[model samples]
Every structure is written in C-alpha cells, then in structure tokens.
Target chain A: MLPRRLTRPRITLGSPVQLLLLAASFALAAYAGVRLLADDWFGVALWFVGLALLHDLVLLPLYTIADRAIVGGLGAVRRREWTPYVRVPAALSGLLLLVWFPLISGRVDRRYRTATGLQADVFLARWLLVTAVLFGGSALLLALRVRRAAQHRPPAAR
Target chain B: MRDPDAPRLPSSPGFWRSPLRGPWLTSVLGLVLLVGITVLFVTGLVSYAAYNPNLSPVNDKTPDKGILGFYLFAWPTSPHWLYRLNQGVHVTLGITMIPVLLAKLWSVVPRLFALPPARSLAHAVERISLVLLVGGALFEFVTGVLNVQLDYVFPGSFYPLHFYGAWVFFAAFVVHALLKMPTVLRNVRHLREEKNDLVSPRPAEPTVSRRGALGFTGGASLLLFATTAGQNFDGPLRRTALLAPHGGVDPGSGPNGFQINKTAVYAGIDAAETGEDVWRLVVTGRTGTVRLSRTQLAELPQHSGALPIACVEGWSTSDQWWRGVRLRDLAALVGHDDDPPDVFVESLQRRGAFRSAALRANQVADPRSLLALHVNGEELSSDHGYPARIIVPAAPGVLNTKWVTRMTFRGL
Candidate 1:
C-alpha cells in the first residue's frame, strides 16, 4: 500500500484553482506588458521600478520607525489596553495626511482653484482640526475606559 | 542541535505576534479589500468602456477612420447622469478604501517580514502574488488621487499607465484570492463559532480587543467617506464635504459655470483666433468643404436644450440651457447628412489631447446634440468654448470637443 504522505493530495505548486487564477492573471499581465512596451517602455519601467524601491526602502522604513516610536512612547501604559485607541486614531490621521498631502501643503492650491473655482487653503486647517478631534476623542474614550476599569476592579486586586 | 519541533522563539514587538495582528483580523480586512477592489475594477472598466475607443488602429490624426485613438468614444448623452454615477462612485469608493487598505496592511505587515521568509514553493508564489496585488493597488490609488487633483507628477500619460496597471493588479488579485481563500474561510468560520479565543499561534494578551480594532478601522473609513463623498453630492452635502477636492462650488456657478477641464490659456488657444470675425465653422462632407463664419452659424436655426457637462474627474454640472445649430442639420447643409455619417469635430486650439474628436453615428443622429454657441441666455464664454463647441449627451467631458472649428463627415 502507498504511504500516507504519498497518498495525500500534494499542493506544493498550488491547487487547481490557484493554478487557473495565476495562469489567467499572467495572461492579463502579459497583455499589459505588451501595451506598455508599445507606449513608453523605459519611462514606465523606471517609474514602476522606482516606485517599488522607494516604497520598500524609504516609505516602509519611515512608517515602521514611526510605528515603533508610537509603541515605545506609551511608557508605563505600554501594557495598557487603551494603547490601540491612540494607535487607531494616529494611523487614520496619517492616512488622511498621506491622501491629501498636496492640498494640505498648498502644492496644488493654484491649480485646484483654477480648475474648480474653490480655494484649497482651508484643507490644512481642516485636516489639523480633524486630527485634533480624533486624538481628543480617543483620549476621552481611554480615560473613560480607565475610570470604568478602576471602578470594576475588586479592592484586593487593586 | 536545535529540536525540529521546538516552539517558535518569540520575536521583537514589531516582528512578532500582537493582539491586534492575527489571521482572524487579516481575514476580515482582506475580505474588505477584496470587495472594495472588485467594485473599483468593475466601475473603472465601465468608465473605460463608455469611451468606446476602437483600440486596434488608434489614430490621433484621422479620428473618424483608419486607426482612431484610445480616447475615441462617442460618449453617451442618454441617461444623462451615466458618467456622473460611474465616475462619482469610482472616485468616492477609491477614497473610502484608503483607511481600509491601511488597516489591512497594518494587520499583515509582520508576516511580510516573517522569519525564514517563505517555507515552501506554494508560499513563495503566494508572496509574489501579494506583492503584485499590493503594488498594483497602490499604483492605481496614488495615480488616481493625483490625477483628480490635476497633479501630473508622474512622467507618463495617465490613461494608458492606469489602464494597464489595473489589468495587472486585478490578475494578481485573483491569484492571491485563490491561494488565500481556504484559510480565510476557515478563520472566518472559527470567529463565527467562537471556537478559539485567539486565532494566532502565539496568543498575546488582549491589550486591544478585536472588536475595538474593527471599530477603529470602520470608523476611519466612515470618516473618510463622509468628508470626500460631498464632491459627488449636491446642495447641503457639498458644504459638509469640506475635504472633497471639488466640493462647495458647482462647476456651473458663474458666467462660465460649466466645469472648465482645460482653460483656453491651458489649451494654448490664442484669444485673437476665437473672435467672431476670425472664427469659422468649417464643414467638409460628400459635396465639399464649406466655411461658415460665426454670423452664418448664428443665422442657422438656433435650438436650445438643457444638458449636463459631466467631467471625467468626477464632478458634474447641473443641466443648463445650451443653444446652437444641430450637428445633423449642419451635416445636412453639406451632403451625406441622411445616414448621419461619423462627424469629426476639430477645435481651433493648436494643441491638447482633445483638440479634435470623432462623433460616431449615434451622437450625430441624436437631435439633442448641438454645436452650442450660447450657454444659459448668454453667448459662449471663451472658457466655455466660445464661437462654437460640441455638446452631446452621455459623452466624456473631453469628447464633447470644445472650441470647435471644423466638422468632417466620414460617409458610412
């Protein structure tokens, strides 16, 4: 009789569905490659390659370092349950900043105004206010949680 | 010697398991990513198809025949808000996905740097697909965000790069989903059953409950949606959409309220060239070329219709009164106006991606389509394609070619 390992359905190369999906994806990717090559091969390739390098080497490191600082900055409350409250709001604020950096920084102010007839000067102040609110709300929630925990703890445990 | 079955040594905080980071959370966020990306891809494709560019022999020169370019769709004018709905959803959903994407990445980032990197061939394939999915998704979102803001930071043209990138991204996404589906289903089932207190192999203390993590992510997405969705909505919603790129001001606000995609200055159109005496509405059809001055065009039976100008950037104007000569009537002035052959509308502007556009038979046949010379009750403003412009229902903003000077009919 065949051994159990031999009898098992091996998926070292991925299951049938995975294989099919990969094949179809590869076909579409090949079409894209052909199209891009026909257009501007060097420029597109450089942009994509530069993007990968910049993201992995620069952006990823910067965000990772920032995250580590957040975790480490908690001091005695590092072990506390409320740290994620801070982390969530901070991450969200950072995302908004990332998405609207051009507008917030006034880089696109003239262009935006010309195109839409709407001033973009308010973005910076609005973003700052939103960030402040998010953090303030999180701090309040954390404080409330802390108060509730203190109240619930038995005198001996406390 | 190290024992083969020894417990995995605990790693540093950023490199190891945490309560907020686990297969369960990953599965949840991954599901969101899956749904969000699917919607974006489908809607994006619908927008692309609306262009209806005959891709085989893409001709920038002779737009009517022999290799018409990629931007060649006779954008539909019917169901008038078609572009508005598709592009609005496209941009708003794209914005909403930012927080969800960030949370999804945050949940699985440690795994990206997992010890030993990959354990098997299957693992390596999975990782590769993940790279494609993430990279492609990021490229699309980043480019889209930039383009909508009129920021052309990228070197290449926006359309082709974005179009091709989407295909690659969707392909990789399909493969990634296939590889991860089983584990995702298993983890989701476990969560539903409450069979495991923690889904990770290493059960870290519950510093942050899963519910708290999910709530934070959801709240962030909701906040972003609320702030950005106002651009697409009208009236009070616009006031609240403070963060929307083009909120608070309708494109149809003043003397030239219709959204100005490319200004006369931007299109390199000389002010002197657009003057009434200097401008001529040229029509070339089966008979011959005929040049009609602005006075002649004004003399032609002027008709008015209320039409919306929907920009590809996602902001649309309300229906405003537009008056001009019907394109079919103008073709009838020449010959081959019966079958309503394909009409090529050429702009006076010397340069731009949309200097000239080909109007398919359908657009020409639509009586609503006009060479609009007057917007509202006033003569066309220079910024609103003065002298004459093509305004057709259901076409992309660019295809409603502005500053029109010539119309060549390709007899079908």
Candidate 2:
C-alpha cells in the first residue's frame, strides 16, 4: 500500500478556474442548444442522440470485433508482431473508405459527377489501389524488421 | 517466430487494450487534438463572421429579425489569401485530425468504464462535459466531412446544425482542457523526464510499445493528410490526392476557367433570364438607388485583378483575372461615399441559400471588391454570374453573390 502522504486525496480534478471554465462551457452549450432547438430541434436532437449511441455501441463493437479477429487470426499463426503492421494500414484504409462511402458505393454517382465534373467510376478503383499500397508498405516494413532482427541474432542462438 | 517449447498464448478480453492507453499517450494525443480543434474552431468562427449573418438571414430578406449573429463589422479583404489559408488549414487539419481524434478517444476508453461514474459534483460535471466533448466532436467531424462531400446524410440543415454543434464542442473542449490540464502536464513532463533519464529502463509492455503506437497513429494521420489535402494544396501533390472530392477541376473553360460552386442549371437559373438586354444591376445608396444596364456597367472605369474563388466546402480555384467596377466605386455612385456602410447583395437567382448575402463595411470599402462583369478577357458566362457578380478579395464563394441584381446600403 502507498503511504498516507501519497494516499491522501488532492483537489486535482477541479478548482475555481476550472469551475469558471465549466460555467462558460455550459453557457455556450446552452446557447447552442437554444439555436438547435429554434431550428429543427427534434431532428437534430434525434441525430445527436442516435449517432452518439450508434458510435459507442454498434460502431465501436464492430471495429473491436474486427480488430480481435485480426489479432486472433494472426496469433494462431504465432505472428503476433505482424498484427499492428496489418491493423494500422487496415484502420487507415477503412477510415478513408468511410469518408468517401457515397462515391465508392456509386450512390451519388450522378450528383458527384455533376458537382465535381469528374467521373465517380474511378473512386472504387482508387480506394482499392490506396488500400493495396498501404498493405504493401506495411508488409515491406515488416520484412525489413524481420531481416534486421535475423541479422542481429547470434549464430549459436539461430 | 516463437520458441517451440513456449506455451501457446490464450486470448484475453483485456488483450485488445492498447499499450499506449497510459496517461502520457493520452496527454500527447490530447494536446495534438486540442491544437487541431482550436484551429478548426478559430477558422470556423472567422468563416461564420465573414458571412455577416447578423446583417441578414441567409434564407430571409427581412434583416434584424433572425439570429443575433454579431454581424456588426465587415470581414477584411486585403491579404487576398486570407480565406484560402484559413479554410485550407481548417479542412486539412480536420481531415488529419481523424486519426488523432480516434487515438485520443481510444486512449481514454478505459476511463469510460470506470466503476462508480462519479464521486462528487466536480466529477459529475467532468463526466457530463466528457459526454458533450465526445458527442459534439463526433457530430462536428462527421457532419463536416459529409458536407464537404456534398452528402446530406443528416436530415436537418447543415449550417445551423454545424454552427451550434461547434459551440457545444468548443465549450466541452474548454472545460475538458481545464479539468485535464494538470494531469496532462504532469504526464507530459513525466514522459520528457523518462526520455531524458537514459539510465532508466523503458516501458516493458511487449504487445505494442509506445513508439509503435505513436508511429502507427502518426502514419495514419500523414496518410489521411496526403490523400485529402490536395483539395486545397494543388500543385503536384494534387495528383496523389486520391480522396479529394473535387481535384481542382474548373468546370468553366477558357476565359471562364474557374471552379464553380453552383452552376446556373443547378441553381435553377433560367438561361433566357440572363440575356444582356434583359439584365440590369441596381445599386442602392444613402439618397437613392441607381439602375445600370449591362452596357453601362461595361462603360464604367473597369479594373482587373486576379482573385481566387474560395468556397466554404473546402475547394478553392486558381486565380482568374476579373474585370469590373470596384465596390467602393459603386458605393461612391451614391451620396455618403466615404467609409461605405454594410451592403446587402442580392442575386438574380430566385432561390438558394446564398441568393443574397450581407457585405460588411470593410468589404464595401475594398478597392479589389468588384462588381465583376468579365472573367479573364471574355464576357461572363451565365454560369459564372453573367451581367455582374460581386467578387471581393478573401470573401467566401457564397458571399461573392453570383448574378448580382441589387445592393442596398444599410445606413452607417
């Protein structure tokens, strides 16, 4: 156990300045709430609540499950070190996909083409290419790391 | 690559937590996120103010009845790249911040599940603010990204929702920072000391080192940056911007080769309505309003300068030579010429979010502020606001007031 000196509680969380800031923050939020309510309160409120729950529940779990599957699948092969190398690229690619979902899905093909004066047909292919580059780059880094580690190993240990 | 005699590892629920879930990682990522959020907020405020929403409602012609937008002063016009740079950084930083925001959120995930959610009033308030911070941040980023893509996934209007959400997020950000500063500073200093104390052993977690976590997060941010920043950065980097929604393509060709936010067709503007003979620009002053024919407008002392059309949607075009009467010159046409007052610019288009806009005093006074009649060397295309449009330096594309029909100077 820690000594009494370290165990004693300190007022680290809040103070006068922090309280004042909290007040100001609350005031700002209240003002925004009024503005939001004045303009489509129900719809905006529903979006906010629904989105928050969706992110925390559905999206978080979905990503978590996906990550675990990758970790588990890689772990079974005793390739734990390679998990992050794959995960980072995958996550980044997924985020890019999320940001450009409409174009990739061809849902907004006509609208996008009309607005941007560019073909939406190339989006899916471009995303695929970017994803491939990310994975390829990661694989290269992993290969280099393995080569360096192998070189550093003693002959007897090898 | 494991020892043959070593026992096989068993999957655990806690194994998913990142090794970078410590205070130091949170602090560093939080600091970066703070800087990003601050930049976004500041630029967003400038953009909002530039709208001069206080002068007039975007959707309504009846001024002084809508929201008190503090539209008291006109946004500046000099240093022509002002809006371009602010909006560029606003958008690029927002995109790069995706990874940082994710990492910061992930770093603090464990805290969300902490037992007994609050112990005191302060803790309760902190938790409340945390909810606002997370919710507001998510709302802002998601809506912002979608809006830039012109995807109206949400049901309500974008401007008001986004504007209000910004305040909520900003408030939460301020409070969260205030509450977390001591802890954040302590952790940051602890990290620095650890780096300096070479004799001390490094953190021993083998799943993923702090360096690895930082590397991956930073790499994701950089990748996001490289892929999306071309919307504003242009140049050779533009080709690599695979994710840029509008890759610097100017819809108009030749003398009119400048990117467009709203085309005549898209804006529901009839082609026949914009004929030179039928078009006339009305300029209201202190004493009276003067109507000028297209030919008369052409006869005025025309000034030419290159100016970029920067949009709030985060796409900007290369500078195109614009020729027309200066706004100050137009203001001079009527009495009370010196230090011109705020002017309400009206567009010929029957309906649109930006059919009309309020131009602040500074915008009214700027010499570069033009009631443009021609682009490059040719007459303005119907799509490029034929007859006349207001093109002010550093003003948002929307406020450039396409197909300008009237300008009523609000009393000084």
Candidate 3:
C-alpha cells in the first residue's frame, strides 16, 4: 500500500518508477539544452520554441482560413460536394511546398550548386509541374464521377 | 451537455470543425508513426555507428557522447552495400513520413491550447513531457530536412546538435509512446469513435469521411516516396527523384559523370600537390616507413573492383570500376603480411571535416578495399581524388580519404 502523501494527489504520483523515468527524460533534455545553448544559444533556443509557435499560432491559422474559404466559397455556389476534389490536391501540393520550400524557392541555389555541382533551379519548375498534374488529375476524376452519376439517374427524377 | 459559459473558438472545443479529428483517426496515425518512427530511430542510430565514432576524436563528431555510444560496434565490411542501404532508407523514409507527422499534430492540436493548462500535478507533468515531445520532434525534423537541402541556416555544427537533439527527442518519444500504447490499442480495436476533446462538439457537415482522410494522408506519403527514393539508384530512374538534392542528372559526361559530394576544389585540395611527381604514398608499420610515388604504386601489381560511394547526405553513386593496389597489399609492405591490423589514413585536402580517418582491422583485410588509382577505364580526374584515394567497401564516403599523403598501420 502507498502512503497518503504520495497518493493523495494522484495514483500516478505514487508510482516511483514513473516518476524516476520522467526525471530521467527531463535530465536528458537538459543536457541537450545545455550543449545546444553553448554554441548559438539565441538561434538554437529561438528555433526550438519558435517553430512550435509558428506551426500552431501562424501556419495552422493561415491554412485553416484558406480551407474555410474554399468550403465557404463552394457552399455559396451549391457545389459543396466538389470540395474533396479541390481539398485533396491542394493539401498534397501544400505539403510538397512545405517540405521542399528551400529548394523550390531557390534559397539554397549557390550553396547547393557548389556542393553537388547540380543546379537548384530545376526544383521550382518541377514543383509547379507536379502541382499542375495533381490538380488536373483530381479534376478529371471528378468529371468522370459527375458524368456517371448523371447517366445513372432516372429522367423524371432528374 | 454543453457549458453555457464555455470559452470562445479554439479554447472552447467547439472551434475545430473537422468531424474526422477523434481518437480513431489519431490512433491510426499514431500506429503508422509507431512503426515508421521506430525504423527512423534505428536507422538513424545505424547511420551514426557507420561513422565508427568509437575511434574517438578522429571520426567522432559528437564529442561528449559518453554512454550514448554504447551500441556502436566495429561497423561491418562483408555485404559492401550495407552503408548505402542504411543511409538511403534513413533519408528517404524520413522525408516520406513528414506528411503523416504533420497530420498527427493537426489531429491533437486542441490539447495544445487546452484551457487552465493543468488540472492536477500528474496532468501538469504530462503536459510538460508533451512540450518536450512536440518541440523535440519539430527540431529534429527541421534540422534534418534543412541539412538534406544544403541549407545551413540552423546555428552550430549539424553533427553534435542533431546527435544530442535525437537523444532528447527519443527519450520523450519513448515515454510518450509507453504511456499512450494502452489507449491507442483500445481505440484502434473498434471502428466506433470515442467522445473526447479531439471530437468536435459542433462539427460541420462532413466533406470527407474518416477513412477518406486517412487515405489522403497515405496518398500524400506515397507521392513523397515516389519523388524522393529515386536518388538511391542510377540511370533513368534517378531523374524521378525531383524532391531529393541529388535528383538532377550527373554533372559533366561519360564514365566519371556520377555524383561527388564535394569537388576537389571545394575540399581545398591543392592540384599542384596532388600531381604524380609531388604526391607520395607514405606507409608506416612494424617494418618501418616506406615512401612510394604514384608510378611506383602502379608498378606494384594493380587490382580492380567495383564498389559504390555512399554519402551521409544520402546520395550514392553506382559501382565505379576502381583499379588500384589492395589495402591488404599495402599493409603487407609495412610488415603485417598475414593479418592486416587497424590503419590510420591521412589525406592532402587542406580543409573540411574528416581530413584523416581510421579503419578497423577487419576493414583493412577486406578483399575489395583499395588505394584506388584509376576510376573507370581512364586515369582519375582531379575532381575524383586525383593521384590516389582510399576506397573501402560498405563505409561512409567521407571515410574514403582522398589524395595520397601518409598511412600508419597496426597502432590505431
């Protein structure tokens, strides 16, 4: 049986193994923190915390608003059913942009060329081509589905 | 029952209108990450071990890595494709999993802004651990992605920062996984969605079903894999890896046109010193030192073997026909004729990280290992390690020291 002081707050607090493991996790994080701070403390610390805020406070809101606009704009035209066709392709393209932003934007052009002896300029064109394909493919699928549905309906009901 | 006085928007649990953001969706994504991240961590550790950090100070990039290096052993030499497969999988899979990770975060985001912060002492501790888990994940992924792109915006050297950051992230990740495993199992067992904070109290009409959302995420990951995995191969397929740094066609033409991580010029190799007349292969061991010129090295019987050069940056070249004197042959010249001992190799490059590297005794004895003099049928180009270079099987590209300088055997 555990003592009252330990268990009074919560059952988890009474588990010594859990507490010990938690302490170890904190210690490891601290060691990494100290080593990271030793060199570029300001940059490292800013990136560590700032990235989280950027995702939650900034990127998330921007995307959510964009998604809402898509939904709202389509709903007004009585074509809300077409949202998936637009959303899926947009989400996939946005993800590619997010991952390969540096290359696609040519931000690392000089350094990348010097290091690998290959041009970074190819990325921007390739990304645009890929985005076009995704949207085109999705729109084609939607057209097929719409045509099939119209053909299957009874004339009187239509 | 909905609280009449509940907070507005995101803090109120009513703002997130996705009907699909619930335990089932979160758990499915969690399961994918459970399998995917475990592979990432193991392969990441294997990539570290490939550097042979146990050699200390020479190849060891993470200096204060005390107990963290317990799993590292003398990396193998038999398969020859070992390092190539390890690095290719590590980098390619890491990029492929980004969409899944972002989706998982999006699923559980409401908890990040949960009001009052903590309801109890245990709750507060759990929240703090969540902070470490989230922060550590973003830090590792961002740094790793930036490095692959040749962007060095992040502060400090990539080696120690990544090594240490991995430990912190994995520590919290393991704890978080352990705590959530039971709940995840229970949630995934049933198709029935459970009510929780993740479930929107005022969800809008469903544009996409839960299964549809999962499929979209999986499809996104598949797309990334198609665009990224081609960098590991050769020929026409290599052009498909548009998202990877080495996806473009090889620079220049003909046989020596394949990828090179750094040019001779960029590595600070002085072309004047690397010339056949000035460069000398210095071999030292129990028999004392022997200095041999490039012409003399070619005179001592040449051997040819095909082997790939795999870089830590995750790009690799297909097997180039390398002709040279075997490392074991050189070791024999320095007295250890029967079994070649560990050797320390130095290079003429005046700059960069691994100007010198050490190899284990087994690596020295590998039949394929060479002091390569000619790549393809032609004499070596200045960009491809000029007068002479070390070429060992299944080792990281950096460990294959370039330009002939000196070698010390049996005392590493």
Candidate 1 or 2, higher TM-score?
Answer: 2
**Top candidate, metric lDDT:** 3
**How would you order the candidates by TM-score, starting with the best?**
3, 2, 1
Q: What is the Cα-based lDDT of residue A136 in candidate 3?
A: 100
Q: Model 2, stretches more than 4 Å misplaced?
A: A1-24, A142-158, B1-17, B59-72, B191-205, B233-237, B286-289, B334-339, B410-412
**For model 1 chain B, the run of ten residues with the poorest summed lDDT:** B59-68
CAPRI accuracy category, model 2? acceptable
| Top candidate by DockQ | 3
RMSD of each: 5.7, 6.1, 3.8
Per residue, candidate 3 scores C-alpha lDDT tens digits across B1-412 of: 3457555667768767788899999999999998988888898899999988887479888877777778999999968889999999988888889989988999999998788777755567778888778877888889999998978888888888778778878888888888788789889997554677899887878988989989988999999999988888878888989778888688768767888787887788887897767888899998999999999999987999999989887778888899999999999998999999989999888888888999888889998999998998878777788788889999999999888599999856
> Residue B36 of model 3: what lDDT?
88
For candidate 2, the per-residue lDDT at B287 reads: 78
Pick by lDDT: 1 or 3, better one: 3
Docking class of 3: medium
Estimate, for each residue in B1-412, the C-alpha lDDT of model 2 and write its tens digit. 4336432321222423444557677889989987889989988878777666665566332232234354434567878888987787888788889888877777666556554567556677778887788888998998988888778887577887787788878889987886778777887888444321111122223567777788888988898788777766445555667876766344545777556677776677776767777877888888798988988988889998899888888877767799999888888887657878878888878766788888888887888889999988998887788878989899888889888888888753
Cα lDDT tens digits for candidate 1, B1-412: 2335545443323334456666688888889888998999888877876665652122122223222133445556678778778888888899888778777766665565565555555566666776667777777888888888778886577777777778777888877876778888988888454323233555445556787778878887888788887776556677667666776555566646655677776677788998777888889988888999999898999898888776767766667789999988988888865777878778887776668777778788889889998998898887788878998887777878888988988732
State in Å the error of residue A126, model 1.
3.4
